[model samples]
Target: MASFDVESLFTNVPLHETTELIVNNLNISHLDKFGLDKVHFRKLLGITAHHSVFCFDDCLYTQTDGVAMGPPLGPSYANAFLCHHEQDWLEQCPLEFKPLHYRRYIDDTFLLFKHPSHVNLFLDYLNSKHPSIKFSCEMQKDNQLPFLDTMVTNNNGIFHTTKERLAWEPRLTIGSMREPTPFHEARLVSGANSFGRHCQWVTGLQVLRSQSLRCSHLDFVRNTGKRTIIERHRATRC
Candidate 1:
């Protein structure tokens, strides 16, 4: 198994190139009739400066390639753009090197390769596909590795998971803030149930095989998200 990160994915995506790629890949004649052809799209992007025009510290500039990281549209556009390449890779992967499982969220990707010998070769091939988008890979130590908020372990062909404390979560304290609704606050503790459900769904592992927290630690675990969760909810409401 190998873990790969797309280095500077959002900032590295070439805007004009990605748009052109999307247009060509779509190959929809109706898009041309609707004036959504590559030429028109490029012209529209010029108006938005490929949606990369911005001012920082009172200076104006334009990004030559890549969309702005902060825009809501950037992620969706970037993911769609990468999908083309991902599909090609899947189609072209050698049978012996084909991954047993693959998963991705935004730029983070986890791949379960069938053979260890093919792992580095696969990573090299992926990185060589595009000069701007490069993948950095890690081979798992032991049978366990961390991805997002879950600790994944492969026991032979079976997969299991354990709860992990994401770095983004704050440490627990007695004075954690509360949500206005009981149901909202309860998810901090109960969210583990969701996590368990997600692990089961993703890996088809029995829920009983998952990591279990000590009863005494529930308060600490649940309370960790209290302040941040409330703050996020309040922000969204405002």
Candidate 2:
């Protein structure tokens, strides 16, 4: 059996003093300029926050836009603005927006690339551009990637899962300020279940598998909003 060293996986690599110095000298200034607090920002931007509630004019929306009409407006607008405000952000973002090649539902982001280098480059770029956004990546060889309950394999021979890529929970301790959670995860999972039930309700089991299969063909899908058991399973599978 393949062994997983959970402790090793979770080992805390101490930040070098020099690295801290650089961050203090260079990155800290930028972070401060943006009015960002690292600890708070990380909590707010963690995987769980991806599905936090976002109230916009009383119209509910999931970060993934699974139930959205046309394109989900909030994240789309936010990302576009970020891209424009920070040109470097776009250069580093793993998702391709040219033809709208990527999809995001809160913390979960799905992207397609022709080469592994593209993925690495994009990840590196993201790290350089937005040092605030914590990311972890895994590669699947000769298999479909998971996305929510669906699995997506692109025409370019790349695959992605429609599921949350990371597991996160908020740690609220005394003396630590709380961070705002993104509602994408909770919303997407709920929306997917609702949509799935709606499909099953109206279409019945005869067409359920086909509908699910078709949905899985999407290039990107997000499942963070609802935080359901099935969504967790999908993420684990991915």
Query: Of the candidates shown, which would achieve the greatest lDDT relative to the real structure?
Result: 1
Per-model CA lDDT versus the true structure: 0.58, 0.35
Off by over 4 Å in 2: 1-88, 91-100, 154-238
- Alpha-carbon runs more than 4 Å astray in model 1: 24-49, 167-238
Best by TM-score: 1
Candidate 1, 148-202: lDDT as tens digits: 5667798987988776766586343213322111112122222223333333332
Each prediction's number of clashing residue pairs: 0, 29
**Model 2, 81-181: lDDT tens per residue?**
23232344444444542212344433344555555556656555554543334445555444555543344555454433353334653332212311222
TM-score of each: 0.61, 0.29
